[model samples]
Target: MQYAQKPELYATGTIQLWEDPHIAKGMLEAHLAPDNDAASRNHQFIDRSVKWLSTLSPVEAAPKVIDFGCGPGMYTSRLAKLGYEVTGVDISENSINYAKEDAVSNNLHINYRNESYLELKDEGLYDWAILIYCDYSVLSPEQRQTLLENIKRALKPGGKLIFDVFTPYQYEPLKESHSWYAENASGFYKDGPHLCLFSHFLYEDDVYLDQYVIIDEMDQVDVIRVWDRSFTVARLQQEIESAGLKLSAYYSNVAGDLYNEASKSLCFVVEKW
Candidate 1:
């Protein structure tokens, strides 16, 4: 058994699906279908976003928007059609390519960048920055800080940055489990016949780790550690304040329902202070 690399902490040493060709190709296609991925990104949910996000948008002309982790440009093209200047960014080369092609085919003017949003400098001049689908919960503490600061610098004065995150209530009763599958013709790692061991770990009040150990037919091992960092409402607010951002809006979900302890998912809309 071998690891791609040593993890920095819990699950930092892994090649995510975003960087894997075999996985990202399937992911892009899955993104088109409603509720295809583990995450629920159904068409109805996405279409409703226009109204949900509009609560924070300007009234007159469309606001300049930046879609962080804009996967396959799903929301990017839709937002553009709704009359907003949009820019989509993702880490996957395949996803970026597909987004770019779609934009061209549709004759929509959207700037698509194949880059890591975490490494993005404070170089954007936009009215809104959105990171939907609870992508914010996956980053480590340090990365989350960097992301918040970067978004703060990128937004114009009074600009709003919105993103979703999972609360600790949503991840209680930490489950340590495992699953396996025999080599099949199709899967994320489709190189050849392989043994797959999938497992998860939860640290007390810390992070949820989705760890994978795969052995290919050639006896090659691949270890993947995907960490999902969760937060409590109070804790998240404090972190946002530390980043020099003001939490102006909080919701149970993108649907705009009021958030509370019972709400597993929370949407936060912050302003650069």
Candidate 2:
């Protein structure tokens, strides 16, 4: 296999990792994995996060909530259980189907949409919007602007958007690296034998990328790129403000820990301005 030069920033991958059928299956497994934070945070942390989020929109208020990237409805289901009107949007059909099944089994009424949140269209429909699990850090600047605009359109006037982003502290030890592996059986990357070339890149402005090039026995190749952009409070505030949103409050994390410069992540509640 030929070595690939580092890609330009925010280049689209050959496949959308979250929506690819095989990868989606593996993603669902990772999300449901009780012990790992590979796809979603551990269940215990989720419980705490959901509880803290509830305090933001008490059941007595009967608030309408929209959860972006609601993988398997982990947060949406919990919020629904608290009697909040919940809508979950995701790009993965597999995850949405699983979430729908679980919601039905529990007799919980939730609106689950299998679509990209970047294209969110409901205007002035929700009181609270959540993009948890640090998903906000995955987008490029342009994509982020679009997402914030879409979310702004989706929320009521003065409505709030709650999300988290990693900080430089989270990657203080990250370094540029490259490696490869061969998988002969059904695995995270494929259902059959394939060769995988992996690279980890660190860029200026606290940006990082995990790039994977997968080649099957037939020589078909697929490239997957996962980008993360860490943020400082000032940087995050500027980005939101450019989209007509204002930061209302911030914490070290979604769990409501006090914000500090050394924290690995920063969570914010921003209002449509």
Model 1 agreement with the true structure over 1-273: per-residue lDDT tens digits: 223223456555446767888878777778877766353378778878767787668535437999889988878888888778888888989988988999999999999999999988756588889998888888877888888887888888888988888877777776877777787655665566777887777666567887778777777777767778777778889999988999897888876778887888888888987
Task: Give the range of the ten consecutive residues with the poorest summed lDDT in model 1.
Answer: 1-10
Of the candidates shown, which would achieve the greatest lDDT relative to the real structure? 2
For model 2, residues 1-273, the per-residue Cα lDDT tens digits are: 344677888887899899799999999999998778889988888899889988876777638999999999989999998899999999999999999999999999999999999888899999989998899999998889889989999999888899999999998998899999999887798889999999998887888999999989999999999999899999998888889998999999888889987999999999987
- Candidate 1, superposed: residue stretches over 4 Å from native: 1-8, 37-40, 59-62, 122-124
The CA lDDT at 56 in model 2 is 78
What TM-score number comes out for model 1? 0.92
Could you tell me every candidate's TM-score relative to the true structure? 0.92, 0.97
lDDT of each: 0.79, 0.91
- The best candidate by TM-score is 2
lDDT of 2 at 250: 99
Those runs of model 2 whose alpha carbons end farther than 4 Å from true positions after fitting are: none
Model 2 gets an lDDT of 0.91
